[model samples]
Target: MLKTALGRYINNFKGFTHEVWILALITFINRAGTMVLPFLSKYLKEDLQFTYGEVGWIMVSFGLGSMLGSWLGGKLSDKIGFYKIMIFSLFTSGILFILLQFVTTFWGLCFAMFIIMAISDMFRPAMFVSLSVYAKPENRVRALSLVRLAVNLGFTAGPALGGLIIIGMGYQGLFWVDGITCMIAISIFAFYIKEKKKTSINKDNIVLSDLPKSIYKDKPFWLLLFISFVTFMVFLQIFSTLPLYHNEKFGLSEFQTGMLLSINGLLVFLLEMPIVSTLERKGVNKIKNIAYGCFFIAAGYFILLFDSWVGILVISIVLLTFGEIFSFPFVNAVALSRAPKGQEGQYMGFYTMSFSLAHIVSSKTGLEIIAHYNYQINWLIMGTLGLLALLCCFWLNELVHTKKKS
Candidate 1:
């Protein structure tokens, strides 16, 4: 009976096509080399002696670039398709990383960082489009979960390895390694994966008047988008403020901080796919699952309020990981489900822009809060925001349900 259970568990991973696996592999390779951005705030403060305000602005530049990139990538993918955009994004962004290593001045660094983030982020919408195109509708969420699994697995390795690289070779080594891995991902895509051919639509049957309305005009989607932006604003603090918080409050080293960050990835790697699959099999509602995720995220932040102990930190991360597992992949699935036929890229792009928008506000505002007050207040604010986001999720659920009934 135990062996039969084990076999069933193993079989849960078996149904995706070769292209989906390739996409997962590419995600793995790129994310494994994700060394620079996670460490950028630390590098700027520790190495370059930048002030907190300056670091905030630098991150703002990155956010602006990310927002613009998502918009442009979505628009361009709709026009030219995902393949060309993916290839260009990977190759050019890799080269920009190599160039970024040489930039010393603050403005120069900002300019380079902006371009690098913009180019690198273009991959998001293209990848989302590719996932929808390659996977069957029934399997798309599971396919995306596989990709997320690869991402977390790679993330599990990247920061730990990056810590060692930082100790041995300094910050420049991070850029070189990241650039090389991006090229490796690019090669995998160019050689192994052929873009899915667009199915031809008959012009006679296609009513120009019946084309999907612009995303701006879609009220429900916009509401969902707003909720996404708010949730991400809370969620993204893990990247922006949490690192600095760890350093300041707990006096953690770079390696220690990296390990702390990796805990979230480790938990997700171990649990997310199985949980999501099991939940789906049990016929759990995705929207309710997401609401639960929001609550857990808030709980994670709330936990941080009591102490700076290592044990508490670990528990906080665990809660946050559960939140991520429940929320992120399902959110993507919902966004894809809502998109009109032939407009996947545009919808995905807008979906991605929500996170980019969060980056802009989360980092800068988080730092400003920390600069003025304390980490406790920051956590409190984020936890409160998470509760607000939970309410938004419930509203979104009703909105979607109403639309379907209509």
Candidate 2:
């Protein structure tokens, strides 16, 4: 019975083209090498002796750059091509990461963070569109999930590897690894992955005119964006504030903290694709799935309110992992599939920007709250935000159904 189930699970991954697999592999290498971000907050606070507020501001710089990059990547992918942007973003950012270790001052670091992130995050929206170019209509959702799996798989390795690197070479080692990985990841793509011409393909099967062409005017899409923002905000906190919480409240070492964080990635790596495939096959409502995901995420934060036992930490992360697995792939599918064929880059670019915006809010607000209030208070606030996102999803669902009937 177990073997049958395992075989069934593996079956969901089979249909993707070689290009999709290559894209997934590229995403994995790039993301796996992303060791610096998971520990950036701790590095800033502990190694550089920066205050929480300072860290918040630097992250703001990082996020603003990410926002700018997302917009540019989308725009450029439309105007030039995703291929050029991907090459430039990774290669430039790789050089920047190595050089960033030199700047220890507050303002200098802030400027550096913003510039590097702007270049790096350009890779995101471009990559999202690349999947559209590479994947077939039938295989698109799983293709997106494959990339997410790569991300989580990379993340699964990143925190654990990062922890060891920190121990051996201190935080400086993370910078070098991060930088080298970016270049290596891009080099593989540059050498082997030729740029494919964008074709007039419609993955959603619905008429393009049925959906709003302008992202700004699409009310349902706005709600989806808000839902995505809340999800990213909550998830980003684990990397930003939660590490500090583990150190101060739980008295866990960097290695122990990495292990705890790696659990989230490991669970996602193992579960997300199968879960995503199952839901798609069952013809589940994407909005409803996202709403439930919101509840799980909120509960993850709410559980943090009971931090007496170390076991609660493990349980909370489990819930958060479920929340992530449910919402993210569907969100990408809905956005990417609905996009007008010629303007996919704009739609996905803006979609990814929501995440970057959430990163800004997540990092700065989380740090500020941690600095001013206690961890419980911060957790309480985050949980409330998750609930708000849940309510919004419900509203969006009703509106979408109402429109369909009209």
Candidate 3:
């Protein structure tokens, strides 16, 4: 019985095309080298001796660049194609990563960071477009789950490796190592993956147009985008504020913090694909799952309010990981499903833009709250935001169902 179950579980990972696996590999390789963003706050605070507010502004700069990148990436992917945009993004971003090591001044560092993020983030919409193009409709969610698995697995490796590098060669080494990995990913993508041709007709027999389109006209998608933006604002606090909180509140070292952050990725790596597979097999309602996820997210932040104990911190992170596993991949699946043919890049770009906007809001507002008030207040705000997102999830479900009925 056990063997049969295990075999079935393993079988869930199969059936994706060669291109899907290649895309997943590319995501893994790129994410594995993502050392800089995770430790940017620490570097700014400790090495650069920047104030919390300054760190926030620097992050905002990166966020602004990322926002623009997402928009441009979508437009360009529609116009030129995913392959060229992705190739250019990977190669140029790799070069930028290397150049970032030379900047010491505040403004210069911010400018460099902005450009680096803009160039790097252009890969996101293109990658998603590629995923939608390559995988079968029924397999789309699973395909995304596979790519997300690679991302989390790579994330698990990146920060842990970054911790060791920080100890051995210092922060400068992180940039060089990250850049090298980007170049390697570029090589893999360039040699292995071919560009997929766009389909001119969708399933509904709606003719796809090459002319400029307006995504803003889709009311339900706009609502989804709003909900996503809000949820991301709360979710992204982990990247910017949580590290600072752990360092200051618990006096933890870089290695320890990296370990703590890695917990989210590790949990997702272990459970996300299986969970998503199981849920799909069971015919679960995606919106209801998202609502549950939002509640868990709120609970995670709420846990922090009661105590600063390491055990509580562990519990909090575990809860947040649960929320992430339940919600994020499905969210992407929904976005992909809703997109009209020939507009995948636009839809994905806007979806990605939500997170980019959240980076700005979370970093700037969160750091300021910490600088002015307290961590407790920040936690309260995050929890409240999560509740709001939960409500939005319910609303989104109703709207989608109503549209189907109509």
Candidate 4:
């Protein structure tokens, strides 16, 4: 009977539109490569014997490249096409992954990571563009939710697999596996996925700048982007610093760290949408949700300042994950709704820049904090930043509400 219920659930998922499924598959594969990142600091520090400063520099290199890529990728897609941009991004990032096998020096790894991040980020703007083209307006939220599910599922398996590979073969072997999987993903996309084309009549009616400029003028629109930057700063810490903290502070093994990260993703996979619905039903504005998320995030890390047991560590992560789901989707939904009638692609491109900025800041900031102070001190500081973010959200709520009433 339980098997029958699970089967029904699986079938329901499969019944989504073909475009949504295609995007989901592509997202899954891309995210599989991405999941290795959560453990990268550990691999670098342990296997390569790199200093915290060097590790921080490497991440900053990638962030710098990604920032440029995010802005250009959107405009490029507008000039070329989303399908072509996606293919380019996949193959280019795959090659960079394969090249990681040769890097031993700090500068070499930085160069390779920067190239990989820049090219891979080219896909970011295009994904939203293609999704807008494919999904009906009414079905877009569900379509995006399914794609996010694929990301979580992919990470669930990928990081665990990455941990095993690192345990058995070391970091080089993990990079090789990532490169191979990415190549397979590219081939699958090229051979099996169909591109959804915009009708010429529809294209003829719209000017390229019309949509982008309109979105820029909306005050709430830019405020949403700023909040995204802050959220990413908080989120990136999970990937870039937390693993290092676990290794140094708690003396966690690679496998154990992988399990902890997996727990964070698992809760999102299971409960994100339900929580979003609950908050929305309670008449919570997006700003309020973002504010509450920030507060909880701060509190969770503060809780960690005192935690010594693995079990308590797990609880802190659970608290952090709840904040993540609330802030992430709520921010995206608010931005998407505020986008001009036909400018989702442009707005999403602008939106992605926030991530680029956050990555840059977190990579550099996290490393500096660890080097100058200590891991515990760094955590405390980030907790403080979370409070600042909460305050920003309240200011944002007032701004958005006033704009609406006007």
Ranking by TM-score: 2, 3, 1, 4
* Per-residue alpha-carbon lDDT of candidate 3 for residues 44-90, written as tens digits (9 for 90 to 100): 99999999988989999999989989988988898899889999999
Shift of residue 341 alpha carbon in model 4, Å: 4.8
Model 3 CA deviation exceeding 4 Å by range: 202-214
Checking candidate 1 for backbone clashes, the offending pairs are none
User: Which candidate tops lDDT?
Assistant: 2
What's the C-alpha lDDT at position 193 in model 1?
A: 90
Q: Which has the higher lDDT value, candidate number 1 or candidate number 4?
A: 1
Encode model 1's per-residue lDDT on 1-406: one tens digit a residue.
9999778767768788899999999999999898776788898888889999999998998898898889888878888999899999998888888778898778987887788888888889988988888887678888889999999888888888888899999999999999989988989999999877655555677555544477677777787788778888998888888888888888888788789878888888778888888887897888888888899999999999988466888888888889899988888887877776678789989999998989989999999999999889999999999999899888988987886676
Preferred candidate (lDDT higher): 1 or 2: 2
Q: Write the per-residue lDDT of candidate 4 for residues 1-406, one digit (tens) a residue.
A: 9999566445435435677778889788877776568877777777789988888888888788887777778778766778888888888788788787788899988887877888888888888777777776655655666777778777877787778888788778777777777777778888877766643436566565434456657776787787778777876788888887777778888888888888877887777655654555576777788887888788777877785675767877888887887777677667666665445556777888789889889978988988888777877887888888888888888986775576
At residue 192, what lDDT does model 2 achieve? Answer: 79
- Stretches of candidate 4 off by over 4 Å are 1-15, 198-216, 277-284
Candidate 1 regions exceeding 4 Å error are: 1-5, 200-212
lDDT of 1 at 83: 89
Candidate 2 has a TM-score of 0.97
Q: What is the lDDT of candidate 2?
A: 0.89
Question: Model 2: runs farther than 4 Å from truth?
Answer: 201-208
Worst 10 residues of 1 by lDDT: 203-212
